[model samples]
Target: MLFAHDTEVSLRAAVALVNSASEPETMRTTADLDAFFAEHGYTGRHTGGADELAEVRRLRPRLRTLLTSDRDTAAELVNDLLRDAGALPRLVRHGDVDWHVHAVDDDAPLAERIAVETAMAMIDVIRSDEMSRLDVCSDETCDGVVLDLSRNRSKRFCSPACGNRNAVAAYRARRR
Candidate 1:
C-alpha cells in the first residue's frame, strides 16, 4: 500500500534507520561511514570528530527504543528527545524543499536534527490516527520494526524475505 503523506514516509524512514541498529556493522560509530550519511541524506558540515560522532551514534539506541517499545514508552521517549533537543517549531524553506516545519536548525548536531524531524513526524502520526502503523514484525524470531502502510492493514514482516521465512516456518510447524 502507498503512504500518501510526507509524515508517513518520514516515519518509515525513521523506523528503517532505527532498525539499522540491529546490525552494528551498518551504522557502527558516530563518525559513521560517509556512505551511510550520504544515503540517508544527512547533510551538514561537521568536524566529523570523535565527540560529535559519539553523540550521533548515541541517538541510535534511543531511536531503537522508540521503534520497538509500546505506545506509552514511545511517547515518553519522543517527548524526551524533543525536550533535550530544544525543539521549537518554525517553518523553513531550503533548496527544493517547500516550506516545512523544522523543530531545529539547519546546523544543529546530526543527532538533534534527526531527533527533531522524527519527533515531528511521530506527532503527525498520532494526529492522523496512523500510530498503529508503527509496529514490530510479527515473526516470532525477528525483532525488526515494521512500518505498515497497507490500505488493508495486512503487512506483518519487515521485508518480503522475512515474510517468506516466517511463512515457511509456519507451514512446517502445521505439518508436524
Candidate 2:
C-alpha cells in the first residue's frame, strides 16, 4: 500500500467531504449529514443538528484547499490544522478497523475530529512523498478531488461517472 490502510481511508474520506460541497451542497440537512457520516463510517458523538452541519460545511473549503495545495503549502496547512485542533495523537482501535492514530477526543466536535484526522493522514502522505496521489479530477467539466489510489497510479477521474463520460467522448473522437 502507498500508505497505511487508515491513512488512505482518511484521505479518501477527506476527498469525499470536500467534493460533497461541490456545486449545490449535497450535505444540506441533518439527514444529509447523517448520510454522509454513515457513508464515511464516521463514529463518535454527533449532535445531528444545524450547528454541527454548519461547522462541517465551514470546514469543506479549507479541506479542499489543503487537498489541492502544493507539497510545501499542503504541509503548512496540515500543520496548522493539527495545531489549531490541539491534536494529541493516540493509538486506538474501533469497530472492524485495526489500531490507528486518533488525534482528537471522541467527544470533540465532529468537524475538529474530521480535520485532525485528515491532517494526520496527510502527514503520512507528505512524509512518504506521495502528494502526487492527491489530484483534481481530469474531467474538463467536473471540479472534484481525485485520490489516485490505483496500483499504477493511473486513476485520473474522481468517479466512475466522470471516467465513463470521458471514455465515451474518447471513443467518439476515435470514430471521427
Q: Which candidate is the best by TM-score?
A: 2
Residue pair clashes in candidate 2: none
Candidate 1 lDDT, 20-88, residue by residue in tens: 666434566544545555655555655566776676667767777776676777678779888998898
Q: Which whole-number lDDT from 0 to 100 does residue 75 have in model 2?
A: 95
Q: Write model 2 residue lDDT over 26-76, tens digit each, in one string.
A: 888999989988888888888999999999999999999999999999999
Best by lDDT: 2
Candidate 1: residue 117 Cα off by (Å): 0.9
Error of 1 at 99 (Å): 2.2
